[model samples]
Target chain A: MSQAACIVGIGETDFCRKPGSGMSQLALQLRAATAAIQDAGLTPRVIDGIMPFPNLGRAEQFAANLGCENLRFAATIHTGGAAPVASLQAAATAVNAGMATHVLLPAGWNGYSGARVRQTVSQDVASIPGGAIARDYYLPFGFTAPPQWYSVMARRHMYEFGTTPEQLGTIAVTMRKHAQLNPKAVMHGRSMTLDDYLASPMLADPYRFFDCCLETDGAAAVVVTSAERARDLAAKPIQIMSGACGQPYPADEITNRKDFFRTGLSIAAPEAFGKAGIGPSDVDFAMIYDCFTFELLQQLEEAGFCKRGEGGHFVEGGRIELGGELPVNTHGGLLSEAHVLGMSHITEAVRQLRGEAEGRQVEGAEIGVVTGWGDFGDGSIAILRR
Target chain B: MSEYTKPLPELEGHTKDFYGFCKQGELHFQRCSACGTWRHVPRELCAECGSWDWEWARSSGRGEVYTWTVVGRALHPAFQQSCPYAPTVIELEEGVRLLSEVLDVAPEALEIGMPVEVVFEAVTDEITLPKFKRVAAS
Candidate 1:
């Protein structure tokens, strides 16, 4: 909140199921990082800060690859899917503090081509055995994967709010429709109907195959700098109007949390909107993370877009479609688009603000909100304005 | 059900008593001796009172099915043969929650707020797993 920080560039690697070309994570990250720098009409030499998602370590490797001469600040966030935009908070802080000039924010994962398949049956995964507090409590009861773990929350939502599977299916259907317009989307050209969603095999109770996001292999990067620098750059500056990351009490474990129906976003949205000098109604569009369909619905309600328990009705009737009020995930989202750990959601918001979202543009869009959800209950939100 | 081995919980300093009670076929929770706050998944100190002084208080094992999921897909080698199983979270009468496998009812029949009670199953020589079965409506 000191000096305004702005996102001046956005870039991403091609969406692929498998990078059989032996595409390492570093290669994917550098490609997006280079593209983002070039997109901002700035050279890598100007980048002095880097905020990366976990596993993409050491800013020096990135600086070396980008030809950046002075990498002054570097940090990595491991807050699950929420880290990408959540990381922007740290970058903006550094930029506001004058600790760094331009910062590169990147996220990518080879879930399809990498350890995802190998990890399906392997017990060697460190995080699997008594790694997290929640795991220690839930694993013994046969709650192994996310689908099973999150199903508890999903079922509760249904019981408390009468949220139906069809309502959840609406989200998947809406995202797939949006992906149809985005050529870069992994599910582009592949259509899904509500029937398909209902018919999809159940991974866990209340979660069918369509309820989950794709295990994608891709990366996205954004360039953040001072508002002054952003204005001189090539892309229209997306002002960091407001941003926050929060975890409510007992956030470490789902069972220990006070209210499963409420998430950290319930606390964060007010802070973010207040900082932006706006409200959820004032926002033109949203890029809510869709790690699962239930999460999408819950976040919408928790973010104050609708009354709690009303997200099911709010998303109905094509309200979240491209031409609907507060169009969401115009670039398909993780469900249909490539899951770049929600960084691509940031990129999509940038595109919408710049009027560059060709087929999926929300007309007269000047303000957009992007969000991230992870770590059982950690939530992050940011409001951007053109 | 076919016999198999799965990853078990580590019975450390804080968790030993909780599982030790399980070996005796009794459900117990960590209650802060100072503040009388009930806690689950055993911790070193009480969250409410920040007091390390606590005692393993026996639970009545009577609770309602708060939420549940039927994992149609197997995630671990131990569960490969049990392709579809129900994992449930039960909120005990004492206002504390714990995770366990739900049995004696079809997955589709599981409902929120349904009464349930705990039953122990000795899965391995060293570890006894706690499970839940739906209580008949009185």
Candidate 2:
């Protein structure tokens, strides 16, 4: 357990689902990184470390281009949606150990509609060393796509708790409603009805087009340093009070696990909460990862926001709205916002802390919890406050 | 049912129709004889105890439908013809759960904890996916 590292600055390329923006992934990542540095009011020359999400920048060359001389902190992480919080945790550890003064965590992707729709696997995507032994068993069954893999949960929830399609659509619609207020949200003002949801096409059954997220091309980055030193910087301090990364105990995929009702995410949320000395109810806002609609609900239940099987009712009561008990995905979300490579939720948390969010702003928001998207049994959590 | 067929995804691993029973309208679970635990992906070794002693056995394929989602729209080129289908997860009677399609049942008829049984669906010439149908209430 290391000391808390502060997130002093955050920046992002505009969120859009369009192609032919004429920006390579490297350039887009640089735009976000440089903006993060400037947002922290620090010179790029001061940054000595960088942790980019997979496919964003070309490793060492990216650092060289950023003019980071003698870069001491550098690495890349995969597991798709979980990269944001995990990379931030890496940066925080580096800051705590005095490995680097300023750290940059950037992510980018440029395949929405231009060259191809989107690739489900990276050239380097692989099975984990120890526990990922189920590729032989499940891959042959068409349980490949990460979202479709999550469909196991969706089905189980319906069987165990009577969860319905409309209940899942409620999550999507809520995220879209919030996106309508966020200028950077791709689906902003682009409303989707439940009928449109039910009538849409299916990917793996039980998951329709609207039930899944879009593939967008963009980038985002955040700056981290000592919370004490962050006060001296020109940017407002967004404290990274608690952070953690964990995975399912030696399992292949979610379906192969013992408990289908509770996921490993539940294992992560409490650890971050204990580190932050705050409970789920104490937080004023949440920036949960939503690669698929049912997962968000499943995560909510696992994170202790509500009891098991209670999420359907909790969300249906408008508890997830901007003016509700605790507004979730205020900057929209992966569901309605731009689905960058990863870390979109972290960037949204930064915006919420800075109070720069236009229409999706929660009134007087002072606390927030952000999560990472990891499948392959990996997950991470972060607790932040203004 | 329409005569038109939808192309299914090609999965690599087993050379023979190892999972063919699921397509033959039956649920099969793999048992690690050395460790005494059930596995989803048919394997040669015990995933938990690392024992190579294993065999594929028939399961009741009768369990509660744990969770499911009703996809609102078509997502893939292969799925365009099958919009608005209920992809379900059925927890088999053997304490193992598998992702499966709930067929011949209307969307409104789906209920959590409802009893279901396995049915064979020939997705491709060499592939048969195990689908589920709700047990009719007496």
Candidate 3:
């Protein structure tokens, strides 16, 4: 079999929830993408494939603007939060199958402290126009927003699993501490105590003020090429070992889900471990998405990192900290880092593998797993190794 | 449809799940005649035995807390006032989980294995959403 497709180059522009330059979204993509090509030491002419997550300044629109020639492949993948890893895997498949040698997976957005601070600023909030989640169960409940719709699971997790708001707050504080070491993080150095968590006003019971992910304006891009090409181009090569991704149980009603506590990630985990040829215990660093703290715990438990209901104790014991057993979200995750959606985590994994993370790098990290998690239980996992 | 908030969803004219007892202010689920499995969402077919044949019966609406979360972020337009509401999945006595709202209790008071019973909230003129209240017993 052909060797696994590898990430040859990764590039990102400066993050800003709001930029005054009035720079069009396409301009942001061009600059960041150009940086990626440069980082990989290749000309834009080498790019033969493009996989754009929908929320990014429209893929076809960007391609038309960039005047890309010989574009053999161009498409969009629609899984809400799992699109990042899915896109990477798609490109890897194309490359491994010789459909294309170079693939560009790009996504970015400004979800926070933007000039337009209104919630209705963009039609695209890193969500599909009318995905299965939107078209059916959630839309009727007026749950157009993800945090609102997903809070039910967190609340239920609290009720059934005995997870606490303090534990939830601990998830936020942990990411914040990790962010303190990441200059790019939006919530860095802004840690909250359990008291602060419980005292903070409620957005939903069980979930506190600090129990949500931060939405920031930023853009990140990733470049994928065959393993042999990556070995020749970059000084460091991070092997894209395997990926496990899928949507929620489709037959399961969007609203009347059988178990709100469990997710498709629970289903995706075993397949991922099977593909990676390792169990959860072998993972040295984990970049589990913290779109919400509840998701962090749910994903950890479902992915077989620990048994069910042990997430709170696992986190309370400080196992997720910078030097802990399995340092997660060293880039502060989507919680403390930036939620230009989950693309940043993918880039961070590449950075960690390259040993470029200045301070938050896991000690002698050999195996890193990054997960794209959120949006009513749609997610994916990427296992990377040095 | 006219815009009016109802505490309960309209169950009339809906197929499956709630037995006649719910119309009489009770909750119910379908039991598999072959496997004795209780199924929620009022399926037209039994999930357990893959039998289209099933039976409906009134349930105590009592069960243990399965899992739940409190939404801190206001996501729904209808839930603008309901932001930070607790949504839960309760495992009923008949062995079926139903997603509904929880009420008359603090988050700290809610726990796994806590005894809970169904309570309906009047949301719209024609609808009442099934919610749960702690029963003070496991």
**All candidates' lDDT scores?**
0.84, 0.72, 0.70
lDDT of 3 at A107: 76
Candidate 2 CAPRI grade: acceptable
lDDT of 1 by residue, A216-251 (tens): 788899999988777677888888988898875666
How accurate is chain B of model 2, given as a TM-score from 0 to 1?
0.80
DockQ of each: 0.63, 0.27, 0.29
Q: What is the interface RMSD of each candidate, in Å?
A: 2.0, 5.1, 5.4
Off by over 4 Å in 2: A1-3, A114-144, A192-205, A249-251, B1-30, B42-93, B98-138
Top model by lDDT, which number? Answer: 1
- Shift of residue A234 alpha carbon in model 3, Å: 4.4
Question: Which candidate comes out best when scored by DockQ?
Answer: 1
Return the candidate ranking by DockQ, descending.
1, 3, 2
lDDT of 1 at A96: 84
Chain B TM-score of candidate 1 stands at 0.91
Would you list the clashing residue pairs of candidate 1?
A: none
Superposed on the true interface residues, model 3 gives a C-alpha RMSD in angstroms of 5.4
lDDT of 1 by residue, B63-111 (tens): 9888888888776667776868888888998999888867787888888
